[model samples]
Target chain A: MNETADTMNVPRSRAWTLFGVFAFVALIAAQVHAVLTSPADRDMGHLQKILYVHVPAAWIMSLAFLVVFVFSIRYMWRGQEKDDLLAAAAAEVGATFNGLTLVLGMIWGKPAWGAWWVWDPRVTTTLVLFMIFVGYLALRSFVDDPERRAQWSAAVGAFGAINVPIVYMSVRWWRTLHQIQSSPSTMDSAYVLGLRTNAIAFMLIMIYFIRRRYELARLRRATELIADAAALGGT
Target chain B: MNAESSLAVDAQRIARRFGARWCLRGVSLQVRPGEVVGLAGANGSGKTTFLRVLSTLLKPNAGAARVYGHDVTRAADDVRRHVGFLAHTAGLYDDLTALENLRFAAEMLGRSPEGLEASLDRVGLARVANDRVRGFSAGMQRRLALARLMLMHPRLLLLDEPYANLDAAGIDIMNAVITEVRNAGGAALLVLHELAPAAGMLDRVLTLVDGRIAAEGDGPAANAPTASAPTLASAAGAR
Candidate 1:
């Protein structure tokens, strides 16, 4: 009993800590190169620079939600606490990127559309997606029981996952002011490298965030179990 | 048959800790079929922790345990099939009527809803069958929980503080349930804060001190628990 029972409670390895260092460095290098090298857009000029941050943030936001979806299903199917913790970590990361995507979209929208905000279908659905996950995070806070919290989070993840594809296709499905997704084939070649570079950078940063959050969630679960063990006068 | 298969519980050197405090320090016990064992310990003595481990609600920090023939950690779903766990709380839905609660439990346990009225009657809740649990008193709620146990017919009962919040009649009802388990050739382990109320019925009593099984006692006479038996003496030495 004196022994530390779980490997999960161990501190994050030095390798991962070093990876965090590398990820931030990569993000800085990627951003600096993209902003300096890309030619100004014919119409939008320097405003095109925001795409380096905006587009990748949107991509990572969706990717994070997809992680939540996969892990949520895994939690439901397997009832493993690790799957639930991982899904929760992805949701927190997804919400952060979701907010970033929306904020950047607004920054671009103000000049591009002559308004800071719009009710465009893509914008509306993305905002809904953000709220849905923020609500998921909020729902987790209100539950005290770990098992109940996991089940509830999985339910909310199901709703949030369904909205991801809709947010992706809002431009095509509803034909709103939001532009269709950009790609290497559609964009000028000079911008593609910057976009792809930033995408990888954002991905590394997202992984770092999710892993850190997951480790904390596991630590918290350990305490919760200890507390439950100590309940009813545990010695 | 193997010792594990013949015994209702076979816990081997079980241990658990909270931070630096060792709550269950290499404790071990074995109870045979049709026995009603009492686990008597003071506050903070790990009695409930041991019960939780056996019930598959909590895992041991060290060692292994089996409920009947199933390994509690690996074959938990199978162990759960034969165990009825009654925690300190009633684990009831306050909004559901007495009858509705039994029906829901029966459904979850894959038991038929038939004879639910009879089940409620056995626990003296049939008269209040249609009333919501929120309106019931603590004793009544415990009765309702006992009613649920009858529905499951689990082979082993891990009851935590079963005598708490019960009146004299309620205690009698509980004792009858324990006897019922024995009569059905099932076994039960009861966690007790005090031993007298349930003394005569217990086939064995194990006293826990600082997370170790420091002592044991025999049937009925178990109210005066003695030092550890040979099996746990070796485990205590291992610690």
Candidate 2:
């Protein structure tokens, strides 16, 4: 058991380091490729460059939330502390990306729709998803017991996940300022390549962020256990 | 296996560290079936940490603990099944009545609520079983917690400061509950600050100082005054 745990730790740290370097290179490459290869849109010109950032951020935000949902369920089902930590890590990363998506969307909207903010279904539901997880993080902070916190947060994480699909479908379900979902097949090949490359870069960065966050969470739990032991003393 | 063949609590070279300090440094002890052992320790001496570790709530930083030969870390589910832990707090929901609290515990443990009323009566809380715990005195809440323990009938009892906040009657009830558990061939590790109150009920007493066992003796030996040792109550208060 000790050997397995030790071996796993080495690989995980190395993997995170590799992901960090790769993500940085991929992000720069994607940006350069999009600028040089993709033609300016006739309608919006260079403003369309924002899609490379906006769409990928939105995709990764949804992906991160999906991770939270899965890990939260696993925590509840298996009652493992690692699962709870992973869920928390995913939620934190997801919240950051969700915020980025909103900001980027707003920036894009300012030029495309002549408004910085709107009550569009896609925008409103994504905002709600972000707020729900923010509330979930706040709830975790308020609970003192580790077990109780895991149980409550798992419930909140699961409930918050229901909003992900709603946010994804919102643009299609309603006539909104937000455009319908786009796919690689639906867009010009160059635009598709740029978007895909940026998405991969963002995904790698998100994984690295969540992994590091999980490490911090584990360290915090260890410190808490030690402190608890110190406070209580030996019987 | 017979009760005598199985160890109720067996902890060996246990160590739990916090930052640079060790709260439980190579502490080890054992309790057999039908034995009631009292643990007297100064504040922050790691009494509660030991109990929490044995109860499968906290993992020891080193060494191993077993209840009936089931390792705490490897078989926590089995350890949990055989152990009942009552901390200084009642661990009860204030909104629930005494009866409701027991019912909730019973449900969580997957045990029927058939004997909850009897258990409440045993703890002298039957008269106020329907009263909300929010309105109960500290002693009453403690009794309700004891009632919950009685219903569970765990094979090993880990009581941290069981005498805390209890009146004379409550103390007697707590003693009776411990005696009953021993009489049924279960074992108990009772963590206390004062030896005088539980001395008569203890088969043996272990004194902890600086996170290690300083001494071990029977009831009479515990009552013998030691100039350097401070009672748990005094040490706890100083902290």
TM per prediction: 0.73, 0.73
Q: Which 10 successive residues of model 1 chain B have the least lDDT summed?
A: B230-239
Residues A1-235 of candidate 1 have per-residue lDDT tens digits of 2223264474759999999999999999999999999987787778878889999999998899999999998888988878888999999899999999999999988877677787666677788889999899999999865667889999789877887666768644655445543321246788889999999999999999999999998887677555544542332
Residue A170 of model 1 has an lDDT of: 62
DockQ of 1: 0.15
What fraction of correct interface contacts does each candidate retain? Answer: 0.15, 0.00
| lDDT per residue (tens digit) for residues B109-207 in model 2 | 889878788888888889998999999998888888888877677889999999888888889998888888889999999998776567578888887
Off by over 4 Å in 1: A1-32, A71-94, A139-159, A167-190, A204-235, B13-26, B56-63, B86-137, B165-170, B224-239
**Candidate 2 to truth, TM:** 0.73
Candidate 1 residues B1-239, lDDT tens each? 67658789999888776655667887789988899998876667798999999999887867889888899988999999999998889999999999999999999988889999998888888899999999999889998998897787889999988888888888998999988888999999998876656858888888887787867768656554343333233222211
Q: What is the C-alpha lDDT of each candidate?
A: 0.83, 0.81
Point to the candidate with the largest lDDT. Answer: 1
Alpha carbon lDDT of residue A43, candidate 2? 76
Index of the highest-DockQ prediction: 1
- For model 2, the interface Cα RMSD in angstroms equals 8.2
